[model samples]
Target: MRKAWALLALLGWLCGLAPAIAQVSLPADLTQRELVIGTRVAPPFSMKNAEGAWEGISIDLWRHLAERLGVRYRFEERDTVQALLDAVTTGQVDAAAAALTVTAARRQVMDFTQPFFATGLGVAVGRGGATAWLPVLRTFLSFGFLQGVLTLLGIALLVGTLIWLFERKHHEAYGGPPLRGFIAGAWWSAVAMTQAGAAQDGPRTLPGRILAVIWMVASVVTIAVFIAGITSALTTQRLQGVVRNVGDLRSIRVGAVSGSSTVDFLNAQTVGFESYGLPAQGLRALKAGRIDAFVYDRPLLAWTIQQDFPELEVLPITLDSQNYAIALPQDHPMRVALDVTLLDTLRSEWWTRTRLRYLGNDAAN
Candidate 1:
C-alpha cells in the first residue's frame, strides 16, 4: 500500500511539471494576429502618399518589425498625436509610430520602446515676405535712427548760424538783411552737408573760409557715420523678425502641429500660436501669412521644407531636444519584444539607410 501511494504521488508531480515545461517551451502565437497601429501625418516619419497609401520611415520600421515577429498590422490614421496616445492607452491600438517624442509625462501614461531617432524643435518661416528692404524701412522708423537724425540736424543748424555770423559783414552771399543772410547761410550749409555744391559763393573772410572747411569735413564724417548706422539698423531689424530661439517666438504668429510636444512647449512659454492637424497644414498657414513661424520636429520639418516648401527656411536654433520612439500601452506584453527589435534596428546599418532614404542627405544629426 505504501508503494502504490508513492507511485500516485510521483505521477501527480510529473503532471504538474508537464504543464510548466509546456508553458516555458511554447510561446504565445503572435503570428497572423492583427495588430492595429495608430499614426498621423508627420513627414519623414509617417504620412500618406499620393495614392493614399501609408509610407514613411516609421511605417517602414513598423512593417519591418511586424515582418520580423511574423505578425500582421494595419495602420489606423489618427488626427493627432494625443489621439494616438489615447488609442494605445485604451487598447484601441496595439502600438503607435510617428515622429513621437518621448517625454516624462508621456512615459507616465504609455510605454515607449527604446529610442530609434533623436531630434529637436525647429522654426520655419515663409521666404516671400522676408525681403531685405522691409528691414531697412523698419530701421528708418526706429527711435535710434530718429535720434541720430535729430542730432545731425542740430549740428547742421549750429554750423549754419556760425557761417551766417562770420560771412554777414563781408561776403555778398550773406550781405543782405540779418534774416535773409541767415536763411541763405542755412541753405548753403544744408547743400554743403549733403555733398552737393552750394548754390552761391561761400564766405569770403579768412575766419569764414576756415569755418566752412571744418563744416565740410564734419559733414563728410557725419554722413559716413549715418550710413553705417542705417546699415547696422537694417541688420538688427532683419534679425529681430527672425525666430532664432524659443524666446523670440512670443512676438510672432507661431503655428504648431496639434497635439504635439511643440505645442506644449509653446503653451508653457505663454506664446500665442495656431495649431494644425498636420505639418503640411502648418506650412500652408506659414506661406499664406496666417502664421509668421511654424514650429515642429527638426528632422521631419527640415525634410518637408526641403521637399515641398522650398520657399521656407528652418531656423538654426533647436529647442526641447528629445528622442523619438514607438509608443505602446503601459505594461504591454510586447514591450520587451518591440524594444529588442528597435534597439537592434537602430544599431544596424538598416537605420542609417532608412533614415537617409526618407530624410535625405541633409538630415539633422
Candidate 2:
C-alpha cells in the first residue's frame, strides 16, 4: 500500500509537468545563441516612453514567449518596414514583430502566425470637409439633367411627324382648316433643352403634347447614362471633391518618413507621397504648415502625438490597420518556436499592464 501511494504521487506530478515541459521550446538553428528580434518603434504599442523602453503589443508578447521558454532575447530595433523585412529575410533576426498585414505577397517571403487581429483600410478626412463634399457629389452625379435633353428630342420627332401628316392631309382633300393652332413637338424639346422661356409663338396643339411625351422618355435615358458615367469617374478618381482615402492621396501631397513603412504603404497603394527622412522633420513641417497630413501606422502615430507633438489630434480611426505578427523566413526552424511563445505572451497579465501603462486611455480596451 505504501509503494502504491508513492507511485501514484509520482505519476500525478509527471502528468502536471508534461505540458509545462512540452511548452518549453528552443530555436532550431541558433543553438546557444540568444533569439534575435526585429521591432519597429511605434507608440501605444512598441516604443520608448516615460517609464522605460518598451515594445508594441506584439513585441511585449514576444518577450513573454522568450521568458516562458527560458531563452534570452536581444532586440534589433529598425526604423523602416523594409529594414525589418530585410532582417527576417536575411536571417539577421530570428523574427520580426510589427503590425504587419498578412498579405498574400508577404506570405510568399515569410511564414506568418495565425492572424491576431483583423483590420481594414480607412480614410481620415478633414473632419468637416468629408461631410460638406458628400452632398455636392450626390448632386453632381444624380439623374437630374435628363429632363431637358429628352424634352428637346421628343419635340423634334413630333414636329417632323406633324409636318409630314399635314402635308398628306393637305394634298388629299379640303382646303386645310388653317392647320388649327397645333402645338409643335419640336418646339417643346427646344425649350426644355435650353431652358428657354416659352415664346408667344410656341407649340399650342395636341401634336405638341405628343412631342413632349417622346422627349421625356429620351431625356430620362440620357440622364441615367450621364449619371452612371459621372459615378464611375468619381469612383476611379475617388474624388467627389477632396482627398479621402490613400487611394485619393494623389490628389494631395502626403508626408511620410523617407525610408519607413509609411513610404512602403503609399508605394503599395500607389499614392502620390513625399518622404521626409526623419520623423521629427515631418512633424516639424506639419507644425510649420508645409504639409497637409502625415501617413504612418496608428501606434507610432499615437506615440508621436504623445512623445513629440501634443497639440495635434489623431482622429480615432487608424488609416489602414494590419495584424501584428512575429515573422520568419519560410524555412526558418525557429518559426514554430517563435509563434508558440508568441501565443503564450499574448495571454499574459504583463501584456495587459504594459499596454495600460503606455496607452493609458488610448489603448484599446
Candidate 3:
C-alpha cells in the first residue's frame, strides 16, 4: 500500500512537471530566432526617417516587444498596407507592424495582437481659395443655368406668338412678311418684358396692348425667380466644401490610400474613389485639385495635417471606427505570446509615453 501511494504521487508530480518543461522549452530557441517584420510608411505609426532607419510608435512598440521576448527582428519595408498584410498572411514575414486595422475579413486570414489604437475614417480637403469672380461666372454658364434660360426663352416665344396674332392685322410692326412679322412682334414683346421700352408705335388693338401690359407685369416676377436661382446655384458651388458623410461622397472626387480600410469602406458604400500608394500622394493630389477630398484613417490624417500640411483641414466627422493591431499569420507560434505582451504594453505607461511622443497632443483614447 505504501509503494502504491508513492507511485500515484510520483505520477501526479511528473504530470505537472511535464507542462512546465514544455513551457520552458518552447521559448528556449527564441533568442536564436530572427523574425522578419513587415511594415510600411504610415506616419505616427511607422515610417522610415531621413537616416533610412525605421521610427515611429509601431516601430518602438515592436522593438520593445522583441527585447522583452529575447527575440531578434529585421524589418522589411512594404510599399503599401496591403503588401504588409499579405507578407504576414503568406508567411513571407513572421509579423506585420503598422497601422493595420483589425476587421472580421482580415481576422479570417490572420491573427491580430491586442488592439493598440482606435481610429476611424476622415476626410481631408484643401483650404478655401480666394473667392474669385471667375467661379461665379462659371456657375452662371453651367448646364443648369443654360437649362433655365432655355425654359424662359420658350415662354417668351409662346407669349410673343400670342402678341403677333393680336396685333398683325392693324399694327404695322406686325404687318411684314409672315416670318419677319413674327420676328418683329417677338422683339417688341422682349423689349417690353425687359422694361426696355420699344421705340416703335403702340399696338392699335386694345387686346394687344392689354396683353403687353400683363406680360410686363409677369416679367418682373419671372426675372426675379431667374436671378434667385442663379444666385443660389453660385453659392452652392462655392460653399459646398468637402464631404461630411458617405452620402456626400458621390458628387466629389475622392482619394484613398491603396490597400487601406478607407478603400474597403468606400467600396462597401459604393462610393467611387481613386487609390494612391501613400497618404502623401493623396494629399498632393488634393492640393493640386486632382482630387476634391482624401479619405483615410482619421488619426493619421490629423497627424499629417498637424505635422506637414497645416493648410489642409480634416472634417469633424468620423466613419467605420476600427482598432489597429499587429498582424501575424494564422496560428503563428508567436501570436499568443505577442498578444499577451501587447495587451500588457497597451495598459502600461510606456505605451502612453510612446503615443504622446509621436502623436503629440492628438493621441487617441
The whole-model lDDT of each prediction reads 0.81, 0.60, 0.82
Provide the lDDT at 191 for model 2.
53
lDDT of 3 by residue, 193-289 (tens): 6777652655778888887778888988999989888878777665544454688787678999888888888999999999998898999888888
- Which of the predicted structures, 1 or 3, would earn the higher lDDT when compared with the native? 3
Worst 10 residues of 1 by lDDT: 21-30
What C-alpha RMSD separates each model from the true structure? 10.1, 8.1, 9.5
Give per-residue lDDT, candidate 1, residue 133. Answer: 42
Q: Encode model 2's per-residue lDDT on 256-335: one tens digit a residue.
A: 87655456577777887667765667767655556656666566565666677764544444455566566787887766
- Per-candidate TM-scores read 0.72, 0.57, 0.64
The alpha-carbon deviation from the true structure for residue 335 of candidate 3, after best TM-score superposition, in angstroms, is 1.3
Best by lDDT: 3
Task: Put down candidate 1 lDDT per residue, 1-365, tens digits, no spaces.
Answer: 99999999999999999755433211365454777889988787888888999998899999888776667778999987888889988989889998889987888889999988887888887774753244456567768889999998888888888888988888877877888888888888888899876446787889878988998998999999899878776776666546656766776678998878887788888889988988899999888888888999888888899889998888677888879999988887787777766666777787788888877775446
Between prediction 1 and prediction 2, which has the larger TM-score? Answer: 1
- Model 3: residue 74 alpha-carbon error in angstroms: 1.2
